[model samples]
Target chain A: MSAANPGATSPQTVHVPLGDRSYDISIGNGNLAEVGRWVTSLRKVTHVVLISDGNVAKYYQQPVEDAIAAEGIRVTSLGVPAGEQSKSVPTAQSLWEAALADRVDRKSTVVALGGGVVGDLAGFVAATMTRGLDFFQIPTSLLAQVDSSVGGKVGINLPSAKNIVGAFWQPKGVLIDTAVLKTLPRREYLSGLAEVIKYGVILDADFFAYLEANVQPMLNRDPAVLQKIIARSCELKAQVVAEDETETTGLRAILNYGHTFCHALETVSGYGEYLHGEAVSVGMLCASRLGEKLGVFDAESTQRQAKLLSALELPVATPKLSETAILSAMQRDKKVEHGKLRFIVPHAIGKVVLTPDVPSEMALAAWREGIEDESA
Target chain B: MSAANPGATSPQTVHVPLGDRSYDISIGNGNLAEVGRWVTSLRKVTHVVLISDGNVAKYYQQPVEDAIAAEGIRVTSLGVPAGEQSKSVPTAQSLWEAALADRVDRKSTVVALGGGVVGDLAGFVAATMTRGLDFFQIPTSLLAQVDSSVGGKVGINLPSAKNIVGAFWQPKGVLIDTAVLKTLPRREYLSGLAEVIKYGVILDADFFAYLEANVQPMLNRDPAVLQKIIARSCELKAQVVAEDETETTGLRAILNYGHTFCHALETVSGYGEYLHGEAVSVGMLCASRLGEKLGVFDAESTQRQAKLLSALELPVATPKLSETAILSAMQRDKKVEHGKLRFIVPHAIGKVVLTPDVPSEMALAAWREGIEDESA
Candidate 1:
């Protein structure tokens, strides 16, 4: 295992090696200052369509624009509301109009300058507008920097289902400035840790152990620990995305280990009630039960996850949904194929796999057991 | 050149051949009857989402659903308004919600059963829902059958831009039923012939000569003439899409020979006011003028286009857009990379080339000439 040396004088960078879609994620305090020339090109960019929500736009928008414009490239900033609800068709339409009003020509690059909601919605608009245009990501929040901004899984939500309308469009580049973490609320910052922890469990055992050892420092946003954590998590995500950009194969499903439960939790809770990472934190606890039921995980493994989530003050159990409702939501999940309830479950610490046909009776028992647990 | 034997005992099938994205356009009569069994698997398909517009659905919904259901696939039909207004986000959202209410799962397929408006919106929904699901096209109108349905160009119109929001999602297979053309309004039917003429002018000279000779029969929607026209047009579009699905290289730009003007016209006239093919017919005339100004085409070729559009009863002159307004709209065109205006102009009959750097002054002059002619 090649552990990224955050101690190296060179800043740690996670390469999102997607051939034509590939980009690099640089982590550390001063990474934001390097944005001027790190972006794809200075010559071709006639304009930069900076798409951010009102919140993040207020803080980081000026610095990001100044860095890009320092190269003599024009910048047009577009801001929308800051929330999950902002990820809608109307919002996308408004952004489309804004892009036009800004004279965002085909040569113009769209910059998603906020959190997950902004990244997904803006990337989607960039993908569809003019049948696939390029966009860059400058994710502001922990969740955005570690998860949404790196993967290129851009989409908007439909009224009936979450993320029910979108495309698998990628970004040209992603710029992660850990220094920006200073502005995130404590709860929002902790929510982002759930995904970073997920990468450790799914792909790298050592990375998982490192996260276990450094959880407190990470929460404190220590620049050294934060850079290592963000860079490794991005590398893990980028590897999974490279193996399967379209999610046609099961390799990509592993990335959704906690997502099936998380989606149902979000859907039932009303999206805004829970941050995506919080839902996943709860969903991970449920998945642990299913793994135990299937004999793939032991009690100690479940306890480790519960302890980790609890230590981080993240939700560890399903909240307020009947077993039937969870099952129904799973049926509508994008991953469900041919009427089967499929799930991405971890077999043990640092090892994940997809189970397409878990016996329904077993699944029900697992859900019942998970929801009932005091830790859950 | 593979000559399509128009008078053969069985209609000669022209394969669009888009590598991994390619599907056959069965131009023979009675293809619709075989659709249920061949395109969609009766055993695996639990439900069918049949999406059409109110106008087309009124006439063909029951029969199409009945036929698919008879093959053991459950069917749920959804209808929207027939015009370009239905291509908005609101209409797409309604249909997306309906699909969820109808319990559309991954195994289920959406069958786009109308003209370009229905096909584009439904196909866009299918592309985004669940990251992408399978869809089949049963194009009832000539424009869809000949052009939009064959290539995987599915999308919706933004209020500020036409077809500005969309994805390149291919259908599982396209079913062209020549039988449905009998009920089409005369203007709409002839409007479709413009796209047919475009394919000939852009790719196949013989196809152009054929349209010239058989104008009367085609205008009457002769089954034999219609099938030949649709097959040839699909072949041209399919070939272009196959080579350049992303449109990064110059190959796919040739498909937009007249679309630069057409999109501007659609925007200036308000999308619903002009059928896409109707705009293209006029746009083609404007493109011919640009070609002449650039010295790629002669006055004789321009006159020939004017004559053919007149014979088809299609508008040849530009609409009421002033030269400056038209130039501004053209600048907004998705095709313009950087501030330079790029155009796909016909070099001569049956040969079009995409020029990436059309001189702005010359393009403005051509726009001026077009506006003057329209006013005259």
Candidate 2:
């Protein structure tokens, strides 16, 4: 999976139709070069505030600032420490002050120029900076480019939980250049593949079959496969968002097929041990096992999923979390309604349902199946 | 202006019909007692995370919690230190953790029981907690009851600015009990009168006249007059909200008759020294003055506003901020567009327009009139 692969070339353009919240998710070669024109068309922006993490800022900040400035807008690039820890209230407060000091007024457009963590933090900041402002997403990581950038789920993590403080703020536009994938660590790219696999399992069985067959190519970062997967994933998410913009209906829950368990694992493991995609990889296995146990899915389905994830070199089993800890973590999941566990379990590949009440015993059984229980 | 005063005794209710975003603001005696029933009827709520600040919690927490519990719904009260300082991302993060720890699920309701600060913070948490959940308001102060509770404008403030992190999250219900106003400090009570005055000046000149003629009686805490004023203000705000739920239309801009200048002043002043209403009182004067300078408003109109504010014991002139500082602050205001200053200036009482390209000199003159040279 080398960046030199011809298919690894960047995308030309992609569209995300979310009704009034619709935005374009353009990927391809040198997409970053067109950020100024893209952002200007989306927002009546003059002053630009480019928010990036420290590491990415060191590399891409100069070019991004220059691009936006070339449009005759003053650019203030704010660099925060990169990692999960940066997505906190204190960091958001600091960014708020930095923007104030830089005089990034309401007319200024906020450009999040990093991975998922930066996108979430900066998007949340822009969403609430002045009761909301236009934000553009230049997702630098596979996870952010394919997933977070599309759904408008911007938030910061809490010490006790992940993404406990946030909002459903849509971005003005998302600029994805596969060229950035060249800079991402291998482990991070694999983690992102987990989300790509998730869209297949939850929405399109044919897509799932495509993923199963092309797992090797995807792992190798074949540009054609990668671009197709990213586009399909984003399209699926955008369709869901258009139907249920605020997540009121059941349409949006399908997008959270593995997120219920994934978020719990992310929070309990302290957020940094495993990236979001890794957690989702493990979470999907648990959800599949749960579905099988509840008679909603067959055992063959679980094996097929395990084979696909294993091929991607993604985790197919839960981590070494205790049942009680996992239960406690799951209890903190945002999906719980009236203290009853709600799981987005698959009825079949390409189809999912949000169960308001997943039987406690079945959930425990699946958790135990995926994890070793020292208690029982 | 005693509670028994003829003008302050009768109950009034204002309806904010926003389709799925609709809610009612009930102003009168025993409204608090009916909260459990009203909210219960609106949603399948079984538990409530009641959030309040120290001041209101001290006097009303136990009673409110008990009443909600009496309705057979579980209630968990979380109290924070009372003040504008509490409207921070950190405080909101803490609340999210507390809600998680208390087993607050999606079906559980969050009841905000305090003033504008508490309402804004609590409502924002509910808006994002689990990607938003049901929330109700038990506004205890004059300002919150008449203004914050009805509009569904919930959020927290950044150190650099007020209400910098928040959302336009509508509540399931807003229960305004005039009985709770009895416990508010006299200064806070007077501060609320400022917002009530804004509603009149923006939408109902007749209400403005009513306020002018009965300012003292209302400030004296006469429940009848207060009820009338609160209901009228809620009705005016509700109509605007119905017309423009997300503030995208010019209809909602009318609601910011004084807020463009008010938010700038609040942001520059650090949100500590001035109550929101106090800043708004001064801001209205600034806007009127700016209008007069631009020949949109007559000099006599500005003078009349100053005299009316003075009669109500509200600040009629801006604070001692510098012209440059105030100008910078206005640039950060949410109303600005694409690097241009936009002001919702009134041509006359009850008639406001959102003008996007106000002359810089007129704006500067307005700022100069509102500031002291040394304050810069």
How badly does each model clash, as a count of residue pairs? 1, 15
Name model 2 segments beyond 4 Å from true.
A1-14, A258-276, A286-301, A317-347, A353-376, B1-10, B212-220, B241-346, B352-376
Instruction: Using DockQ, give the best candidate's number.
Output: 1
> What are the models' TM-scores?
0.88, 0.84
Q: lDDT by residue for model 2 over A279-309, one digit each (tens)?
A: 8988888898888877889889888888888
What is the C-alpha local distance difference test score of each model? 0.79, 0.80
lDDT of 2 by residue, B14-50 (tens): 7899986787776787677777777777788788999
B1-376 per-residue lDDT for model 1 (tens digits): 1133346325445566666566665665666676677555523566788898888988888878888888888888888988878899788888888888888766678889899889999999888876778888889889888877766888887776667778888776777878789989988898898888888888888888888887677777677777777877888887788787766677888877789888878877876688778889878877888889888998898888778878998887665666677778888786776678898898998899888788877876665565535436
> Per-residue lDDT tens digits of candidate 1, residues A45-163?
65788898888988888888899889888888888998988988788888888787776655668888899889999888888876677788889899888888666678887765667
Model 2 gets an lDDT of 0.80
Q: Which ten residues in a row have the lowest lDDT in candidate 1 chain B?
A: B1-10
lDDT of 1: 0.79
Q: Return the lDDT, model 2, position A164.
A: 67
Which candidate leads in TM-score?
A: 1
